[model samples]
Target: MEVNVIFSAILIFIIVYLLFSLSGILFPIDRTWYASLKKPSWTPSGKTIGIIWAILYALIALSLAIVEYKIGLKNTSITFMLLWVINYLANQAFSFFEFKAKRLDLAFLDTAVVAITTLLLIFATLQYSVLAAILLIPYLIWSTIATLLAWSIYRLNK
Candidate 1:
């Protein structure tokens, strides 16, 4: 990869992860509130969630970098940009609804949007970069799992 490409990837990684970190900070996970909820047995541990999100964010950054290199940012379609924006907003909304607002139902809906946008992102990126599309598969799968987990929690609690 060219130096510029590597830098672009690094920058994307930093920006994406920083946004996620900021969301977490704003929500500030309420461990006491979460523990009081009726989560499913399959729910992952806190450490596991952290590790998985870190990897997923890295993959997302790499995928975006590949897309940027294959099709210059200026050339990306408006639909693609809209999907990315929706995905980011939906992802952030989950944290706000679940941790900050303590609304599991809304959080579940937010996660559903995240999963759908991730799927759309995969198909949208496929047009410009096969590698980028492939890289997003894990994120799509993870988002699906998260949506299901959120639903499970909502069902159990409600």
Candidate 2:
């Protein structure tokens, strides 16, 4: 595909990803359960949760847009970009299913996928653009910690 077409495709992917991710804010899922769960003592406030995700997703979107604009989505960079899209969508879907369906097992799996794919994105981003890669560091670190949290939730709730 042409670089422009690829960039457009990635843009669409990102928009859809954000729209779906935003669903958590729109609908009140089992936040009560989430709250009551045995979170680490340092668990963030609900407001913090919202703000952090918003900022992270914004960074993610911006990094991707930067990659598309500067790198033109025409080389190995596209592969990295595509991986990020895959993980982004997966993360959204996992979050939705985890909360809406109350399927902790599925949520665990999906969250793990998101974590792993994000790591790949971090690695891939380094080659394409250091700035883009650095932008994802917070997300990667959070997801790594999130992986631990998700597993703990599974054990505590199961």
Candidate 3:
């Protein structure tokens, strides 16, 4: 890849990271409310969640950058772009549902949407760039875990 492509990838990653971070801020978690709920013994600490999400966001940005670079933005199919937008919206909805609204049921639904969109994204990217699809595997796996975790929490608390 060219130096410019690398820079663009990094830039895209940063921008997406910032947008996700903004959701965290807007839907700030209520620590007391969160702690009061019954959680799985294996649930990770706040620091751990932060670290993991940081890594995941970095991967997501890189995957998108790779696809854009390999296929070019103008040439990218409308379906591909739509899938990405859906994924992003669903991702943001999780924070709003779980943290801001304190609605686990809605959060679970949001996570499900995210997982589905992510899978579609993987398949869509594969048609254009295998490397991009490969890069998203971890994200899809993590989203699956997140979806299950949310469901478990909802079940336990309810």
Candidate 4:
């Protein structure tokens, strides 16, 4: 509830938003190509995906801020912090692999990595704050689902 936590959350949110946005902007999705993909019937609409990402990004920022506050940003364990950083980078690359590069296999691989990192991030967060760890559960769930979806899409497309 400290001001530092609030400020850190806001700052991290902006940083995440900007960095993620850059991926989308730099390698914009080819709608025509994406539309051609043989997606599963359960695939969510683009709007739904966007909305879910918005919520997940917000939760990610807050969770990270809470963990950082508990552990002290300066004193954080490299391994713990790397979990989130790795997850973010992997996530940002998904668009590149799936949309720009049009590589479903790589996309599926990246999603699996993201899901794995989400688990590590949650476990690492637990050492700092239970609330922080719990906050990341949704992300873990979503990433797992995404990995499955990615695998399905890759298989279907091939």
Best by lDDT: 1
lDDT of 1 at 105: 97
Where does model 2 exceed 4 Å of error? Answer: 1-17, 25-28, 74-78
Q: How far out, in Å, is residue 51 in model 2? A: 1.3
Work out candidate 2's RMSD over C-alphas: 4.1
Root-mean-square deviation (CA) per prediction: 1.7, 4.1, 1.8, 2.0
Candidate 4 residues 54-139, lDDT tens each? 88877887787676566566677889878868998999999999988899999999999999999998888887889988988998
How does each model score on TM-score? 0.93, 0.78, 0.92, 0.91
Lowest lDDT sum, 10 consecutive residues, model 1, at 65-74
Clashing pairs in 4: none
Tell me model 2's lDDT, rounded to 2 decimals: 0.72
Better of 1 and 4 by TM-score: 1
TM-score, cand. 1 vs. native: 0.93
Across residues 37-120, which tens digit of lDDT does each residue of candidate 2 receive?
A: 666666667788778877777777766666665555565655776886688677777667667777777777777888889889
> Model 3, residue 43: what's the lDDT?
85
Worst 10 residues of 3 by lDDT: 65-74
Residue 61 of model 2 has an lDDT of 73
Task: Sort by lDDT, best first.
Answer: 1, 3, 4, 2
- Residue-level lDDT of model 1, residues 71-110, one tens digit each, is 6666899999999989988888888999989999999999
- What value of lDDT does candidate 3 attain over all alpha carbons? 0.86
User: How well does candidate 2 match the true structure in TM-score terms?
Assistant: 0.78
The TM-score-based order of candidates, best leading, equals 1, 3, 4, 2
